[model samples]
Target chain A: MPHAIKMQDKYGKDGFVALLLESQGLDASDIPGFMWKRFPTNKTWLSTSGDAPFQMTGGGLPHAALVGVDGTLLWEGNPNGAPKKIEEMVEAELKKSKSGWGKGAIAKKARGLLYGKNAFVDAAKVVADALANAKDDEKEDLEAVAREIELRREAFKKAPKVLSEDARYLEGVKAAENYAKWVKGNPEWENEANAIVLDFQRPEIVKELDLEKGLKKILASAGDKAPTADLAKSLRTFAKKNDGSRMAARATLLAAAAEFDPNKK
Target chain B: MTLSRLVRGVGMVVVLTTAALAQLKVGELVPDKTFAQMLNSDGRKSMAELKGSPVLIDWWGNH
Candidate 1:
């Protein structure tokens, strides 16, 4: 991690950006504190999980991969073992990249102008300003990103203002998925996409659904008959699987209710 | 622990260890997927917006 930060500092002016990916285990919200305590940097920290775009080839805590401005992998290894390799490769990559209007430089500048705020029109303007003197070859991608900004802006503006519990939950789910697709390759829009999904998964959305499923099954059984061993096992499994949620607690209660009373037995 | 369970646990570990070691190769185009979330000084960022510049992706964690 330190090696990566050092590289970012040394090569950052030459259009080198360091992205630290928090691979699994920790909650998304925990990243800032984690980075601050251990891996502090002005660079951004991204969380990658099951849907990670890149895969690791070996087991280790710190795996590094250097990608060129055109997004091709240029080097891959443990940074600690081959620190010189990264420096050499970045220099080579810098030479190959177009000096003034390289993709990486443009993307980095555009991202700096877009992060943390929600106004798509405002973002589009910022992006437009960054690209105002862009080379002819850079215009296409710049336009595409600007177009995406407008699309996302329109989508959010169109989202319904009021919805019932279930409808709201479903809408949130749909919106998150849609935004996820919209920003599929664009890291600049990841924060908004993350917020959408987090808001949708807020416990309340799944609370009623869990209660309805859990209680309906418990109430359907015949009067005073102890739940069969198989039913007890399944209910226990369900509760365990959903642990920490309200539904899980309800499932546990239902399981207890199904237990055979000693007096009756 | 039963011998069978112990062997199974070791086998699972080996399998996972092997899987974890498989990293990206040089020269391959990196996948352009959006990260779940981003932590940054200015705020969150997306991988998509990171094009045109050389990016060094460090996959690391405390746990």
Candidate 2:
């Protein structure tokens, strides 16, 4: 929760925006109070109930996904887990003109699809299709991914039963695996699932690391590649083709940087 | 710094930025997932309205 706020604070001025979606069927009355205390930022906070984009890709609660200025999804995971990479992408986006990449038709289409209907199922289908094409040896790893998606779907399916009883049970979706055992032990909690007390606890984050300096050092050594002028030309074409996509914006920014000739100018 | 060093620095930023761009597996297309209706102090809002800038969508609850 605090990390999201910190990120907005650090990057908001650089054209970064953060949004919080409460996917659980919680009572809306309690959100403002929670928001006032925990996340005081003016960032958009909304309450959502059924299928969401995060249901497919998120590891758990507090999951954060980064959408680049041009509309591409740059990173998705715990915001704290990859602080440096997030900053790297944000910095890259900030370097571009605000209107350059995000206004294109393709980028808009992609963003719309991400926020549109049946996203979880769509993501699962994507996984299933990829798995179908995978070699036999890759089955185990792919199956694990598929299993997780199925588990989440099952968990989401079981949520209404629990939420109908108590609106505040945030862990109900996650506790689907333990539902059978829990119901057998506590009969009352079978239908009134939210009333069941969970023994599970959340682990605390230990440390936050900064790796950008090291990454910059490695970059300094990576000087030999495509010629600046050639890269700039290719990137401009890429930007025009991709239009409002994140790659195009990033390419446009990079192209300008590459073509900078100090001696000539 | 010397002109050569300055040029190298610029090259480095470009190199690292390109590498970072390559790491992005998912494009910016928003999923067509069913979103619960959004409400706030004002009224209703859609996720699509959040486009035109970098956004961090936190799919979380009061857990």
Scored by lDDT, the top model is 1
Task: Compose the digit string of candidate 2's lDDT tens values, residues A1-265.
Answer: 6666677778765546666676555444455434533443434545544334534364466677887654557788887678788777777766542323223333223223222321334445545666666665555555644554444434444543344233212333334434433334333434444433222222210000012222223324334343345555766775676575434454565456455543331
- In order, candidate lDDTs are 0.58, 0.48
Q: What is residue A201's positional error in candidate 1, in angstroms?
A: 34
lDDT per residue, candidate 1, A89-111, as tens digits?
88876755433232546644443
Q: Model 1 residue A94 lDDT?
A: 71
Residue ranges of candidate 1 with Cα displaced over 4 Å = A40-44, A48-51, A100-265, B1-23, B41-44
The TM-score of candidate 1 is 0.43
Q: What lDDT score goes with residue A103 in model 2? A: 32
Give residue A109's lDDT in candidate 2 (0 to 100): 32
